[model samples]
Target: MPELPEVETVRKGLEQLVLNKKIKEVLVAWDRIIERPNIEDFTNQLIGEKIDSVSRRGKYLIFHLTHYDMISHLRMEGKFDYVQPDTSVTKHTHVRFIFTDHTELRYLDVRKFGRLTLLPKNTAMDYKGIKKLGPEPTPEEFLLESFNQQLKKHHKAIKPLLLDQTLITGLGNIYVDEALFKAKIHPEQTANTLTFDEVTRLHVAIINVLAQAVEAGGTTIRSYKNALGEAGTFQVNLMVYGKTGEPCPNCGTEITKIKVAQRGTHFCSLCQRIHL
Candidate 1:
């Protein structure tokens, strides 16, 4: 799944590639990928619409068109490519937005899990998944005080609590492990038990780690690529997410992997000691 940073990268790429391109035609090879307005309505309504801009919230992409907002979620295996009209269509290609300029923006998903929904103008933010998201993991939005308050109310394991997207948005398994390791907090630590100092460290770590990941264009784990079809470079900067049995960067302790809430978790046991 493309996490926040990966989605953000895609938004930037789309902004560069597809902005202001009037849709001359929309082809849907797979009907189920359109989640709103019925296939016929969706295809008809977007006929003359121009892509004004592209924005993002959490892992969702918002394509601001001339008359409506198209909400896109690139669930696992979903990707977009801008190409010529004569480009060969692959078996996984699902949606195509051919522009008046003769260029084409195609969406392909091997797993067919991605979704595209069309809604009224300026109403994309009200969508249920986006409306309920926690603030973007930035210093300005994810404040320390609110995060501290939220942490005190959760008794679940810290890793799962963070992954819930209620405490903070944009953190998937990869960034969570990296942030916890950077904060020196164990994955299994109870949320409410974190001391004030620990919480402060975690707050800074989350913001910094995510910022770095975004700067690096997100981690390219598996087959993730931005709309430009470029793989991310942050995977090489990863400290603990997939460094199992490797020596910790700070201390020489070997990293360990465990299952928390059925998700694979990685951390350095000596670096991230459990509070209990």
Candidate 2:
């Protein structure tokens, strides 16, 4: 699944590739991928609509059209490719938006788990998926005090708490592990038990890690690519997420891997001491 940074990268690519282009037609090869309205209605509504801009919230991509906002979630293996009208469609190509200029924006998903829903203009936030997401970690609204207050209310382990989209949007297993490791906070520590100083360090770590990941175009653990079909480079800078049994960068101790909140979690056990 694409995290916040991956989604942002795709948003940027789509803005460059598809912005202002009027849709000549919308072709749905797999009807199930359209989550809102009947397939016939969806196909008819999108025709002749112009893609004004592209934006992202959490892991969802928002395509702002003249008449509607198309919300797309690239769950797991969903990807978008931009090509000329003459380009051949692959077997996995589920949705195709043929632009007026004879170009195409194609959505391909190997797992077919990606979703697309249309909401009326300026009403995308009312959609259930967008309404519940917490403030984006990259923005000024995600203050340290707010983060501290939210942490105090959760008894769950820090790892799973951070993964909650309702608390803080856009953090997944990879960046959570990286942030916790960087802050030297044990993933198993109860959320409310964190000290003010610890929380401050963690807050900074989360912002820095996510910002760096976005700058690096997000980490491509497996088959993740931007809208331009370019793989991410941040994986090379990863410290402990997938470095199981490898020596910790800060300390020589081997990095440990454990199942935390049903997700594979990596950490430098000696470095991130439990502070209760």
Candidate 3:
């Protein structure tokens, strides 16, 4: 799944390639991908609207159109490709937007788990998906005090707490493991058990990890790609996420993998000790 950085990369790509391009037509090759409104209504609503801008919230892509905001979630293997009209559509191409410039924006999803929904232009920010999300980890609103307060309210393991979208909107398994390792906090450590210093360290680590990931265009673990079909390079800088039995970067101890909250978690046992 594409997390914040990957989604942000796609948003930047769409902004450059599709912005101000009027939609000549919309073809929903897979109706299940449209989560809101009937497929016919969705196609009708976006036909003549222009893509004003593209933005991201958490893992969702927000396409600002003339009269509506199109929310897209690339759940697993979804990707957008910008190409000419003559470009060949692949078997996985489920949605295609024909632009007035004779270009095409295609959505390809091998897993078919991606989703799209349309909301009124002004009410998009208040939509259910965007409204309930917590503070973005990279923003100033995710202050140390605010983070500390949110941590105290959750009694779950630190890893799962960090993954909670209602608490910190953008973190996923990859970044959470990296952030916890950077802060030297074990994934299984209870959230409320974190000391003030630990909380401070974690706060800094989350911001730094996410900012760096966004800078690197996000990690490409599998089939994730940006809107321009470029793979991210952050996977090269990863320390412990997928390095099972590998030497730890900080302590030379072998990194270990465990299942935390049902997600594969990696850590250096010597560097990140559980606080039980």
Per-residue CA lDDT of model 1 for 185-229, tens digit only, reads 999999999999999999999999999989999899888889888
Off by over 4 Å in 2: none
Compared with the true structure, all predictions reach lDDT values of 0.93, 0.92, 0.90
Error of 1 at 245 (Å): 1.1
Model 1 Cα displacement at 87 (Å)? 0.2
Give the poorly placed runs of model 1, Cα more than 4 Å off. Answer: none
Residue-by-residue lDDT tens digits, candidate 3, 1-276: 889989999998888899889999999899999999999999999989998988888888888889998999898888999999789888999999999988999999999999999999966778787888888886576888888887887788999888878878889999999999999999999998899899999989988999999999999987888988798999998999889999999999999999998999999999999966
Where does candidate 3 stray beyond 4 Å? none
Error of 3 at 251 (Å): 0.5
- 2 against 3, candidate with superior lDDT: 2
Please give the distance, in angstroms, between residue 257's alpha carbon in candidate 1 and its true position after superposition: 0.8
Which rank order by lDDT, best down to worst? Answer: 1, 2, 3
